[model samples]
Target chain A: MAALNIKKGSSSHSAYDLRDFHSQAERSHTLALIVDNEAGVLARVIGLFSGRGYNIDSLTVAETDHKGHRSRITIVTRGTEAVIEQIKAQLGRIVPVHEVHDLTVESAAVERELALFKVVGGGDKRVEALRLADIFRANVVDSTLESFVFEITGTSEKIDAFAELMRPLGLADVARTGVAALSRGA
Target chain B: MSRTMTGAKMVVQALKDQGVEVVFGYPGGAVLPIYDEIFQQNDIRHVLVRHEQAAVHMAEGYARSTGKPGVVLVTSGPGATNAVTGMVDALMDSIPIVVFTGQVPTFMIGTDGFQEADTVGITRPCTKHNWLAKDTDRLAGIIHEAFHVATSGRPGPVLIDIPKDVQFATGTYTEPRQARVDHYKPRLKGDIEAITRLVELMESAERPIFYTGGGVINSGPGASQLLRELVDATGFPITSTLMGLGAYPASGKSWLGMLGMHGLYEANLAMHGCDLMIAIGARFDDRITGRVSDFSPDSTKAQIDIDASSINKIVHVDLPILGDVGHVLEDLLMIWKSRGRKTNRAALAGWWKQIDAWKEVKCLSYAPSETVIKPQYALERLEALTKGRDRYVTTEVGQHQMWAAQFLGFEAPNRWMTSGGLGTMGYGFPASIGVQIAHPESLVINIAGEASFLMNMQEIGTAMQFRAPVKQFILNNERLGMVRQWQDLLHGGRYSQSWSESLPDFVKLAEAFGAKGIQCSDPAQLDDAIMEMIEYDGPVIFDCLVEKHENCFPMIPSGKPHNEMLLAADAEAFKSGAALV
Candidate 1:
């Protein structure tokens, strides 16, 4: 009930209001969802977003509580403040969704992505790649004379930077697990 | 111990337990078992429709008229796909309808077997909720759940796709009370603190308006009664969305007519200028709030809706009470009365004076001709003749629909049914039949345009077969009147495909279906012709020829704000390059 208190002239106004309408720019937010792990539940969630034309930049879902029959879905989507609020409101209306928490809005939340970089080269390029991997804390999960597959785990931004640095040197292939997010709390 | 029965028998048993008296449906390959069960049972009457689409529309009409979840049964594939439009229409309007669609046998599904369809997949987005029963044991439970989902909180259409094998296989019949559907619970009561804030706002505002929608009707008859009581107690000027008509008695002193795109001039002006706007059960759709940024700019708005997503979906409100309309209105009345029923009468009087000035514009005025009957004049005559009878009016989409909304005055909820949300073209004919079936002795009329009526004209056969006695009052303008009007205004009058050329002789068409047909063109004979259509004991089709070029005015053109309305008097000015802004 306390959260229901109306904020006087809150910065987040309805999209219909002309005063602060254009002031808010669109930004990406990651949301963690706990829902019933049942048939068509995932489809219903996906249908809601797709049917409404809302963009989903990244999405990862897995069964989190097998005993409780609950699955966790992490979705990264971009929208204006008003649009994001509407998305959350709509998601909450879906019957199977037990909880929806925006990790982006949470004070202490961690967002990490695992990526495998297959760098294929020899001599100077291989040595340089190995030295860069050492600095980035990327372990060589798979190694061959011609190719070295580096297993890296970090924030998406860090992984993007590492990939960008490895591109010119010897980056052959890239596989990434889209952002898996959770809040930092007991 | 639960009794064992085939799934087909369970479907019928479940429907009987749900208190369904009649079902509108069509037969197909996958549904033969259910149809056979229906044939054996005397408890539920099944009305076979000519097409699957009309069956859904009829169910919608039945639902709207009786305030019950209308039941529909159609087969797999094309039958299910054909029902998509009507389901979407019901979804948009919040009409409670439970559609049972037959699917291919469990093993044949996804193999593209005969009459196979992904009905659940296709309709997932259109329905409020849907289920695909893969097992026979779940069929009875799913049907019960479908009824629950369709009739609860914010009522809407729900579908249960039962495969042929499931229908044929034996299952334990689960009674309605035994069904365990604990996941989908919608909130029915309003927040007490929010109600307090709303009462505070209502008492303090100078120019207050109650802007209600179809939610008031969908909530129940008691909700409409409470709305009337609230309006009477506060002495506030009230307006409504197109779908919200009949929720408040039109003859009531506080009524300001329907407000929106084609709403009255005074109503739109009042909406734009009001200080306090109370939106009950009405979503702020694009049509209602034209140019959202400029919508109700000065109002401190409060919205009472059963659906949480509807609050702040289009226009943000100062107070958002998420609850059923009846529940919220009951609390509102109690709180207001406890507060000594306080209202600022002086300010309300001043507000009424301003509204009277706007009313002087006579936004609905049209040139009445003695030769060809004006569409508005025809509706006025129809309204005059059918005023006091037990009448239910359904309408097709077009200029005729707007004219009916303007000319007809509804005194009660559920008496006026139309395609408001999706604006389905051919909804009225089958809907009229459905209403007639629900209320056999009542005078049911489908006020239709020449073009929209043709969309589902084949339903004339269904009416004839059932002896529905539903009247089809067509305003034969020989054009898609609304589209033609838009072309005249916005598209430089190119007149593309709006004309209804090569149309059949409706009189002959009526006779071919074994129904009476009356065509009235002369203005002098209009009233008598309408009376003849009314007086006829059997189904009648009255094709009343009207002025083709007449436009539905007092229109807020798409994307324009409510205040920037185009009045009928200003038609010439707009055509002659006057400043529309």
Candidate 2:
């Protein structure tokens, strides 16, 4: 797992500097949402984000409990601290949403994303791709005369790094599953 | 004991169980079944409005004045779209209203059937909550829940879109008590620690001010009473937002007057200078807090509101007490009394002295003319005549609306209803009709500009038919006064499309609707015309012509700090096309 090094600071000065200066910069956060598995619930959540002009970088959802009839929706979004807090508060207010936990704020959470990269080349480029894949612990899921598909699952940052390293080595195409996150505890 | 009944019957039954006494509506093709059910019922009195938009405003007026959830019923498509403005207005002001919009049959909904609309989708952002009931079994419960959601925490408008087939289909009815709505439970009690911190700050502060808003009115009558008690006990100067007028009596000794853009000069100054600012039931709207960074630069602000999300959303506060206004005020009062009602009285006297100096400016004063009536003078005369009586005032958005806020004194909560948040132009006439319905014997007046009055002028038919006797006092400036003012000041006086051209003779128009009409231009005839309108047994439209270019002032230009407010005195030098100071 790796993290992106993004520039961080307040872009403009404010007279009433009531907020902590360090938290004013935009940062990515993964939020775990617990909601009722009901019709229109997902649309309502999506509507709120789109209507308000808030950005959602990644999202994934599925039913988590069969008996309880509850679903978990994991979303990765980037915003300032205040904006993130506002998003959490707003999500909690939706009638069908049972809970909203921001993994960045909770500080004890795991995040992972799966990616499959298809690399096509002849001699040296193909050999280097195989070597890097072994070092990154990625499996070669598919092989053809001209291409080898390497499957990798890890944090979003790690996937980004692997994809960046493979780009120059005949990386023909790539497919990624959006980040899915959960809080780690008993 | 549940019995199977048509969905339309269930809606009426649910409204009855919810204690709804009046419903403002306009019927259409898709709502025939609901209208039939309404006709068969005697418990719920339905007032047929002239337009769907007016129906929603009427409901808003009824809700704001009566402290109860206003109810509206409108048919599909255009009807739902027309009601959008009023719903947004109610949402902005935190007025509770439950609107039931008819939709096309289930199968015909997505196919663009006659009068069909995506009502739930359009209204989702504006309403506190909304639903499209596809199943008749869930229709009754949804109706009950709509009432609950609209009238509950930080009360606002909600919508329930009922398909025609659902109205015809038979479903098992659920009583209000039997409905399953356990998900929502808002915090009603204030945090004791935060309250204590606020009390300590209040007692020790030399310069403190209480800035209140519409939350007190929405928290019910008890909240206003508690607020008055708190203000009296503390002996601190108090000012309120436009929506919060009448929460504390305008005549109260401690009242500094309404604060914000177009607010009293003293109040704005107090807000800028106060060391401890206690914002009760008020979200610091941008209009109130000009230049967010520069707003109350020296104050240690504390806020108490029912909505937690409102806290720190814009202006951060030192203490945020999230709770219902009434409960929070009650707790604060108890703690203050238990601690011997401590306050820095000697320091407060000095603060009042400074406020007195600011009040001496007489920011509301204007040069009066004998031939042409001044808009402010008309409201003053209206106030003089209607004072000490059961009177409720509603206002359309613009210069006249601001003048009404400046001149009319409110002695109690719920007596003044205006479109504060969304600032919808045609709100007051229909709202006045609704208020008149609520208090049949009370004097109901909609202070409107000529252009604004024309937007919902058709509602005169509703007033005439219902015998509402709502007074329409049109300050006939013959212009969109506020827009013209902005053009005159900010837009280099370009004045594009601000004139109210080819307007009908309001007096003749009123007569056509079988209502009394009076036209007055002379200042001398103003009193008589106002009295005549008040004395009329039915609806009266009084068109009082005023000075053409009178701009509402003591104005704070948008994005300027509070201390930099431009007063009426400053307007005299700038009248000759010179730049505003």
Candidate 3:
């Protein structure tokens, strides 16, 4: 939660400053949810965000339990502290949701995303693309006479940095999976 | 050994086991099997409504009036779509209701067969929980679970989309006790330490106030009695939200009246000035909070609710106790009594004195009219005539609803019903009928505005057929009064399409439906007209023509704080949009 900085002489109730109530500093939070692995469960989770006007930057979900019938969804969203708290509470209200863990606040969590970059060029640009991939420890998954497909796995920020560098080296297209996060401790 | 039965029979049996005595529903092609099952059973009486929306509203009335879950059975596609508004209303107001929609056969569900609809998909966000019954073996258990989910925690509407094929298929019947409902269990009792802390706050607080809401009513009659006891022990002033009006007696000495937008002057002022605000069972809705930035900026706030999510969702509180309102109040009282029950009584006397001065302002006062009746005056007369009777009142949204909340004095809980959260216009009449059906000997009235009443005027026929003598007291102003009033104050009197043009003659409309009708326009004839409508043995639509230009006042206009109320006397003071801003 962010601190409320009280500005002097601006409010009648000097003890409590509320002028910036709605303008609290926005920060991104990663929430990991365990839910029933039933039909329309994902839609229910996503609909809550869209319906309540909460912003979802990225979402990834997959069935984690085969016998028990449960799925894990990791969602990265941005909101003020109050709004984030409300989002988590609202998500918990949905009947099928078993648990909601705010990995960002709960503890230091590992965040990873997988991305693929396809660079197509004839000579110098193609060599530069391969050189950058090699330097970043990205594997060249495919290659042709004019193009190379580089696969990389890292944090979202690292992936963004890789894509930014790949643009000058004739990056033709890019595809990235959303973030999947987990808490550090048991 | 469990006996097998058709899913339709199981649906009816499941409802009976849940102690559902009545169901408000409408029938169509896909629901025929269930309708046939309903027809063969006398244990569950079904009141057929003209529209699916009305069915849901009636169920809301039934649920809210009695502390039991209302049941509804509607066909798929159009039927399910039409019931969306009422479901949303129930969800917002925290009314417990289980809606069963008859879907197309499981095989032809997505193929868009006749009367097919994605009831589960469409209603998922609006309902507390929803399911599409793919197997007959799970139908009874799902129905039982639907009732459980709707009635537990923060009570809300739930839905089950049962396919026609499943209704026809045979499955083993599951008893209510056999249903696996342990997956979702709501906490019923508050933490003992937190309850003790609240008791301590009550012990030392001078300017303490109890802000209660619908959760008290939903917790059942025991909660309301416990609340009265708690208030008595603490000697704290109490105010309630619109949905929570009758939870505490309006005639009580410490009652501050209903608080919020359109709330009494003293109540809102007390809320704004209180040193300690203890919110019980009520979510601090925006309508009650006014400008959140300025809402009770000085008070040390504490909230007690069954839903943990409602605790800090809006205005943050210093104390948050999560549990059922009844259970918490009982524990709180027990702790306070055991701790020798102390309070700053001398300070509370001063607080009451200050409140009396605010009450002298009479925020509900309106200018007397000799020719045309005033809406507030009509409600006052209605209250005067029916104050001591076994009365149940429901109201359509807008000016008339606010006036009813102001004028009528309720001494008990579950006696007043309205669309407080959704503010649906067509809610009252159907709800009144539902109440009348549940309590046949009681006097049930629907306080309505003409425009709003006309939204579901077809329910009059349902009333006639069912012999549920509900009084339709329409304060006819020949205008969308609330809308017209807002336009006058905020839009420079640009009336737009706020007029109720070319309305039907209400007396004749009632006559057409084979029910009694009465019309009164003059202020002198109001009491007699209301008496006539009340004394009548059947349904009566009393069209009381009121002053067309009157506005609901003591209004905390959208962005203003509780202190900046626009009273009736100040109606002329703020005329333009700039003044409103």
Candidate 4:
């Protein structure tokens, strides 16, 4: 029973619809994509995600070559074996996606995102905001005119903690590029 | 080229150009500004339905009766929610309707503000397509697309959820959207080899029949003419489902009448005994087919429809032709013409003789006495009054509807408008009004029973408002005639208020609703009353009293064989088939 291969070829259909089944064992997968990082690029990708009702946990991107070149986007989403096949098939069909694969199948990749936050202060309120930012090891990029722009970089959780601390004193706004990840344990 | 005034005004103008003479709507918090703009604009009248549900139904009636798209408007939140049922009804029946609902102000959206609903998301399943117009300039184009989607192919409702802010914000709204289709490319060409096979089969078969359906009418007059040519050439026995009533003029030679639980006995028997059954644009619905395994067991079937999905989805076909019924029938006609296989009168007369005996003893089992008027007697009178003229008869659901479908022979298409699919209770009155408006010169009548007459008595005013000379025949039996008959047969007369406790005088009710009324309690009075009502310049209501619990004769109860039916007289001798008592 355990040897039953319920993969892509298990059924005659090109895809299967059994994502609702729950399992205890956790599995992880990753993929890197090259895309024209222009206006609405994010929206198109989000559309692909939402249309099939897939959930994405982490996403990170950058124009790595910087010759006004293409962008490298790393996306981390979870699914069962059948869902993974569909994701690969659907992602391959997208207009701008150069290629897609389950990196977990090939066994290699890396991913990350940077976040910045701003909070206002200049009195006792300012002192409290500074103290909270310091404990989280967030570097103070600039401080003046009753405000401070704190730069925080790390895993998403570390940035989250720093942002929470700044919130109590005078958190004004947050800018998150979300999480970007690559294949790990190469 | 010159840039025109902003998009919002163009939207209203486009609606006027599209011949959208009326819109049913109610103003709300978000749509007030657009309402103000529309109020200032020229053309396109608007009516304030008390509720959004009424707006959709009215649109449905307008679309169904006129074969044109119905347009509706409503403001957002609960207003849009109210329209869901009407949209779904239109969806089920494949009626064309364009719905415009206001959304919350763009900035105020996603907040828990007043009158905000995710209308686009909610209506996606019910509508063929929906648009959320982000700017006023695009509103005209969006409305144009909505109309196209609503009317094209197998028509269904399309909704446009307009944000209040978008309507208020100015943008260029112009562009005539040509009719564009994505998925529905129906095959018009028939499979020649398969059609040839059906022809060969039809030629060889001794007892052949044609079972036409509502799809023939939906395919338009071309479909009806092509089918009639085939029938006339072959001289085949013919029958129709309830929806297919007017496809074959009921008074024609080949017309074997309706085949169902409440269908003609001769037609039902021919379905069982026939060699080749040309199932044209008809599905084997449960009501018509009786039991699944026994449905036309001896017949070799040839089926065709515009929707490929419907083909082979129901009963199996020995020779299946998947394409538009109109084109296929034309191709079939050409094949026969090429072969020069004209009518064989001798074989046809023999079959007709057999059918005549069945019709005499097994069918047409309505008993008529001097004092007691039968439902079939009223239908016969209605038929005689029309005298085989082109007439539009819309009816409410019941025993009377069955009798009308049986006795009232129809010769025209779209001339008989009944709620065949949805069977909405109040459909008859408004639909009759809509038909009268479309065919102003033609005699239009709502052939409804007392129970159904009360359902939408208000729509009598719609006829009165337009000064339409529509005759409403309220078949008063003092009981829900069809239900009571079923209770008599099935429940041993454990009738649960099938008879009205205290029935209101519908003649007085018609007067209250601003329509002229005539009361006829006797068959002798029927002719004069009908003549006076027909000659009247305005809408008239005829409340005729008839005997209660008059069963639609040759009735096949559910789950029974179609041929095993009860005659009007001889209740116990249904199987042997009895003549009228």
Highest TM-score model number: 1
Predicted candidate 2 versus true structure: per-residue lDDT over B1-581, tens digit per residue: 77899999888989998999999999998888999999996999999998988999999999999999999999999999999988999988999999999999999988988888789888888888888999999999989888888887889899999999999999999888887677766778987877877888888999999999999989989999999999988999999999999999999999999999999999999999999999999989988998888999988888998886677778877677778999999999999889989999999999999999999999998988888898999989999999998899999999999999999999999999999988999999999999999999999999999999999999999999999999999999999999999888777788999999999999899999999889999999888988899988999999999999898988988898899888877764554534544
DockQ of every candidate structure: 0.34, 0.22, 0.30, 0.03
As a TM-score, model 1 comes out at 0.96
Model 1 alpha-carbon drift over 4 Å, by segment: A1-4, A7-23, B578-581
Which residue pairs come into collision in candidate 4? A59-A179, A60-A180, A109-A183, A110-A182, A111-A181, A111-A182, A112-A180, B7-B173, B137-B172, B137-B173
What local distance difference test score does each model get? 0.89, 0.89, 0.89, 0.72
Q: Alpha-carbon interface RMSD of model 1?
A: 6.9
Q: Which model scores highest in DockQ?
A: 1
Candidate order by TM-score, decreasing, is 1, 3, 2, 4
Per-residue accuracy of model 1 over A62-102 as CA lDDT, tens digit each:
99999999999999999886677778778876767877777
For each candidate, give the interface RMSD after superposing the true interface residues on Cα. 6.9, 12.0, 10.7, 13.3
Candidate 3 lDDT:
0.89
Q: Evaluated against the true chain A, what TM-score does chain A of model 1 have?
A: 0.86
On a 0 to 100 scale, what is the lDDT of residue B355 in model 1? 96
Root-mean-square deviation of Cα positions for candidate 2 versus the true structure, in angstroms: 4.7
| Fraction of native A-B contacts kept, per candidate | 0.33, 0.19, 0.47, 0.00
TM-score of each: 0.96, 0.95, 0.95, 0.71
lDDT, candidate 3, B245-353, per-residue tens: 9899999878989999999999999999998999998898999999998998888887888887787778887766778999999999999999998888899899889
